[model samples]
Target: MAHTIDISVVPPPLKSDWNPPAPSGNSVSPLVERRLLPAGPAYLAHVKRAVHKLTFEEHDKHVEAENERLGLNGTGANGEDDLGVGDEEEPEDLLTLDAKEWKKQDHYAVLGLSHLRYKATDDQIKIAHRKKVLKHHPDKKAGIAGDSNDDGFFKCIQKAMEVLTNPERRRQFDSVDPHYEDLESEVPTEKQIKNTKDPQFFFKNFAPVFEREARFSRKQPVPMLGAYDASKQEVEGFYDFWYNFDSWRSFEYLDKEINEGSDNRDDKRYTEKKNKSERARRKKEDTARLRGIVDLALAADPRIKRIKQEEKEAREAKKKGKTGAANGLSAKQKEEEEKKKAKEEAKRKEEEDTIARAEAKKAKAAAANAAKKARRAARATEDGTPA
Candidate 1:
């Protein structure tokens, strides 16, 4: 941390009539020390009350002095409401109830320049403020019979002036203009969701929303997957993209201004620091909102599971085909093996037929030879009596 030193010079105390006694050597108890403090009936908490009282006391004193200078306090001790000389009324209109609600009010509407808020120049804003003030100034009711309180309409015009004259405040307000952005009103409805159940229809209708919200991420675009035939990995990727979506949306344009009536650099810096913390808190809330959207889609959408089942069946069929190809014989190889076996069988059958023919011819020749030999022996036995 950088070391800070107080460079401010302390002025010497004035030599006034009141003089305080120095405390004796420090042997006193805290109770006595606390009681002996010259600040009468004071505590640490009393200091805060003193600050509040001092601030309001100075403001009231200034008002009293101003009214006296202007001779407008004729009824000062009478405990009556002022007749509109130096008094300003704060009406409890809905928009004027809180100072911060100034942001919500259409400043353009407040200034009666609704059609020219963006196109109007700084001179135009000044002129409009002046004209509105002249018409609504409480002093204008001097000749009127009754109370002419318009219920704080003029204060809103002043509020508009404070906002529109400053360039930074005006720019920030323009970014959130209801007429300009109107994002909240464009939220997806149940009817729209049902109508866009088809993938192409959903993309046509709803892609613009997610794109405008966060698809500007250089990493990846988290688009809608509105298909029942989407794969398992596609489903996983879709959820992953949404869950870690890096939205380009920012709270910068809506950030609180540090320049609101800030008199010094230190005060401005303190306001800036406080506004930055609030912006961080709002950004955290926006991120949580995006996360909730993703969670809701994940839980309610049925297309991812259906697509996952489809992808699984397709994978199984593809795997089965590959397995069949791996386990079965090739067509050409099987045909060649069949041809070789048929050739071997034909050759073996031809050889067996040739052997049978040879055996039969040899037996017939032997029988004929035996018959001839018997006839010769019988002819020889004709003389040798009966072969």
Candidate 2:
């Protein structure tokens, strides 16, 4: 037996235009009439004047039919199969495209042009856009090229016009254009570094590594390298920046075990210990790897030696010019010079003393740790437990 519950409907006190209108013989309803477009063979023509979205069946049927016509086995269309199988070009043209890679295709390809993207004048691009608009526009699609192609490709052409026509968007697109070949890889690889020529090429090509690392931090951006003619301070700063590079890499994802649900305290502690050791090891490896790269760059650099020699030559020239001159060092100047030399000597001695103390301290700590370990081992032996 079926149980039924009484449901009551309440009418509003006042009927406004917000309420649905009474049923009508008219095919288009009055209430949502503004939300729709004029009746067309395809529904999307008047709404957004863009691509017609197809249901799974409709899309599949279209693809299957196209495959049959092109004598393809439905893997996907290839350029050999048809002139419109543009998918292969997209990946080859963009290796590091951010998102929706298929959607952000080559604007030139979208407009069905070649070799004129960066060189094409705005008027020429506009003219080409208009011609394409006239050719494949949905308004003219029916009866002209009916069912031969969807509105998607034409919409891409329209989008290409918008992107290629605007100066700023065009600049951004061009920056990531795979054809630029400014740096062959998104991040410099070992091969790229080995193949790189001089400091200029090294600085520019290695920038992508810093850029990749930059996404790890909010406070820092990748440091721009100084030119070979940079001032002493700027050169020092560039070196210091790389020397103190803080990588944001972590090995948390590589944990052998995770302390998730159903783990006891011992299990949790074991997992934590494993993760800690792994993180420390990874950090050490990263620091050493970075230091090695920086060292390689420094050794390969041709500027540092020149800068030092230039400074030395300037000092020697000044000394020779000043010797026995009317403005030669006074007695007071001589005293000040002696004091400065003495102060520098004292500072050097102090730094040496500090280094010696640090080394001694480290040695002492190691000795203490060794003694402690030995004692622990002895105790473990006495207790008959694993050391």
The CA lDDT of each predicted structure is 0.65, 0.63
10 residues in a row with least lDDT, candidate 1: 81-90
Top TM-score hit: 1
> Model 2, 39: alpha-carbon shift in Å?
21
Error at 110, model 2, angstroms = 24
Error of 1 at 335 (Å): 7.2
Candidate topping lDDT: 1
How many residue pairs clash in each candidate at the backbone level? 0, 0
The alpha-carbon deviation from the true structure for residue 169 of candidate 1, after best TM-score superposition, in angstroms, is 5.3
Q: Weakest 10 consecutive residues, lDDT, candidate 2? A: 81-90
lDDT of 2 by residue, 233-262 (tens): 776776687788765556553456554485
lDDT of 1 by residue, 117-181 (tens): 56677766765666567767767766778644443666777887898888777766664565645
